[model samples]
Target: MRAFLKKEWLEWSRTGRFLVLLLVFTVFGIMNPALAKLTPWLVEIMSESLTDMGLVASEVTVDAMDSWVQFYKNIPMALIIFVLVCSGSFTGEYEKGTFIPVVTKGLSRRKILAAKALLLYGMWTVMYGLCFGITYGYNEYFWDNSIAGHLFAAAACTWLFGVWVIGLLICFSAFAKSSSQVLLGTGGVAMGVYLLGMFPKLASFLPAKLMEGLALLQQVCEVEDYIASAVTSGLLVFLCMCMAVVCFDRKQL
Candidate 1:
């Protein structure tokens, strides 16, 4: 397992995907604070044009909360990019016939699936942490971070949402013959959950509600309000992984 994990790391690094993900996430992190800081200036630049059109542009106040809001907003986009990049985790191996050699050499299919899942989860965690850390540091340096309510809890909710998506990606990858199939299956499930979340009665029980971290930051919703969604997401992630392992084990390499 360790050797296979090492091989996966080497491939990720050598393929430039790892560095590209890192760079993209870093830019997102910086953009959160940078955009918040530049908001007033941007509004000022547009104020004259608005005045010419008989529309008044009011003064805009910026703060740590603005940056935090941007953080939550950018995180979903970051996760989307992450899912698109890693959707091929299993299908790529299938196409290259790489798994056959390992399975023939006595590597258990469960271990292979486990290793890939671990790497994907680990990468998501690291990238998410890096982005959060950068945003938090800049927010603290520029303004009072204490102004944001339930900051850490809000961030955790967003991170859990990403984990659920990763689980979906892995589960789909186990049975998909191509990357497009994996993306379609994963995205379809996510979209279904999102649609279900639109129903008031079902919203709390759906994993898609985990993306509402901004509500916590704004103090519009209590942390307790997310408990049901968090629990559902956790269960779905576990189920997805178990399904992935079972499917991969029985699949033809």
Candidate 2:
């Protein structure tokens, strides 16, 4: 496992993808706070412009919690984008026939899959830690008593959502013949779940709740009204990981 993880890291680091992801995540972290600070001014400008068109303007106040909310919401989008970008893990190699040599060298298929998963997880863990550290530092510098209670637990749930996405991506990779196909498959499922979660009755049980209900965890929202949504998200992550392993184990590659 250690050797495989090392090989995975070396490949990613050499390709410069790791650096790019870190830079992007750092930018997202910094921008979250900056956007939070500018939101009120933005609202005021919008109000003035709309007032000229006979639209009434309502008072709006921006706060630290709003910053955290934006951070949580925006980070997931970044994570999903990363997921789509890196969907080529196994499929790309199969298409290019790059894995044939490695596989022939006696590397087990299961190890290969596990290595890639570990690689993706490692990249995500570093990016998330950096993003969180930056957000916490700036948040402390800019606002008093801004950190919400249960923030870590909330963050854990959000991270679990990303893990679930990764697991699905792995499963998709195993089942599909190409990266584009994998992406389409995973995307279709995500879209279906997202649409289903729109109904109030289904919202409590949908995996999409993790990505959609982040604001409540950040103290920028009152979604505590739906405790079931949070529980469902956690359950989804656990199940998805199991599913990924099962699917990969059955794959012919």
Candidate 3:
């Protein structure tokens, strides 16, 4: 298991996917604070045009909350990139028939699936943490971060949402013969959940509610409100992993 994990790490590193993810997350982290800081100046530049159009551009007030809002807004895009990059996790091996030799050599299919799951979850956690840390540090330096209510809880909800997506990816990868199919399955499930969440009565119980971290930060929704969604997300992740393992066990290389 350890050797396979090491090999996975080497594969990501050699292919530059790890570095690419790191750089993308870092850029997003910096952009959150940077955009907030530049907002006032940007408004000032537009002020004259607004005055000529019989409108007034009031003073733009920038704060830590603004940066944090940007953080939540940009994170979904980052996660989408992550999903696209990792969509090939199992399909590549499937195409090359690499798992046949490994399975014949005594590596259990369960261990192989477990290793991939571990790496995927680990990478998402690290990248998400790096992005959050960068934004938090810059926000603290420029403004009071305490103004954001339930900040950590909000971030955790968003992180959990990312983990849920990873679970979907892993499950789809186990059954897919190509990267496109994996992405289609993963995205289709997410979209179905999102549409289900549109119904007011069903919204709170769905995993899609985990993405509503901004409501937590704004204090429009209490931390307790997230309990249902968080629990559901966790259960879904477990279910996805179990299903992935079962499917992989029966899959032909």
Candidate 4:
């Protein structure tokens, strides 16, 4: 297990996947607060230009919540990038026929699947921590972070969502014959789950609620509203991993 993880870590670094994830999230982290602080100025500038057209501009409101808003907005894109980057996680192995000998050499298929999923989850954890830390520092430096309550709790929800995403990618990658198939499978599942949020009763149980991190911190939503979603999402993550293992055990490759 250690050897497998170490190899994956090295591969990520070598393939520049590590740096790509780090850079994408870090940019968003820094950009979120920066955008919040500068939006007022930008709006003012735009308002001036509009003044010549006899257009009255509404007041450009900027606050710490604005920063949190940026944080939440950027998170989905970051997760999308994460899903894309990991979409090929197992597909590449199968395509290259690399895992065949490893499985024959005594490594359990389940272990390989576990390692792949675990590594992706761990990478996401570290990147998320860095992104949050950077954003938190900048937000605090630029504005009053106190306005956002349950900061880490809000973050934990998104982090959990990322875990579920990783599990989904792993499971989909197992059944998918190619990276495109992997993307389609994961994306279809995501969209299907997301649409479930339309129903009031279903929203509480769907993982899509985790995206409302800003609302969570703003107290617009009480924790109870989505606590069930958090727990259910986590359970789904485990189930996805177990399903991946089951599917892989029966997979020819």
**lDDT of candidates 1 onward, in order:** 0.93, 0.74, 0.95, 0.87
**What does the lDDT read for residue 78 in candidate 4?**
92
Model 1: per-residue Cα lDDT over 1-253, one tens digit each: 9989998999899988799899989999999999999999999999999999999999999999999889888888999899999988789999899999989999989888888889999999999999999999999999999999999998899899999999999999998899999999989999999998999999998988889988998899999999999999999999999999889888887
Q: Model 1: number of clashes?
A: 0
| TM value for model 4 | 0.96
List model 4 lDDT by residue over 1-253, tens digit each.
7788888888899998999998998998999999988987888889978999999888787877888888898988999998888787788888889898888899888778778877888889998898889888987887788989888889999998888878888888778799998888888888999999999889989999888888888888877777999999989988998888888999988
Tens-digit lDDT track for model 2 on 158-218? Answer: 6766776776787788767888888888788878988998898897677676664455545
Score every model by TM-score. Answer: 0.98, 0.81, 0.98, 0.96
The 10-residue segment with the lowest total lDDT in model 3 = 94-103
By TM-score, how accurate is candidate 1? 0.98
lDDT of 3 by residue, 106-172 (tens): 9999999999999999999999999999999999999989999999999999999999999999999
lDDT comparing candidate 1 with the true structure: 0.93
Model 2 misplaced regions, further than 4 Å? 40-61, 145-149, 212-253
Q: Which segments of model 1 are wrong by more than 4 Å?
A: none
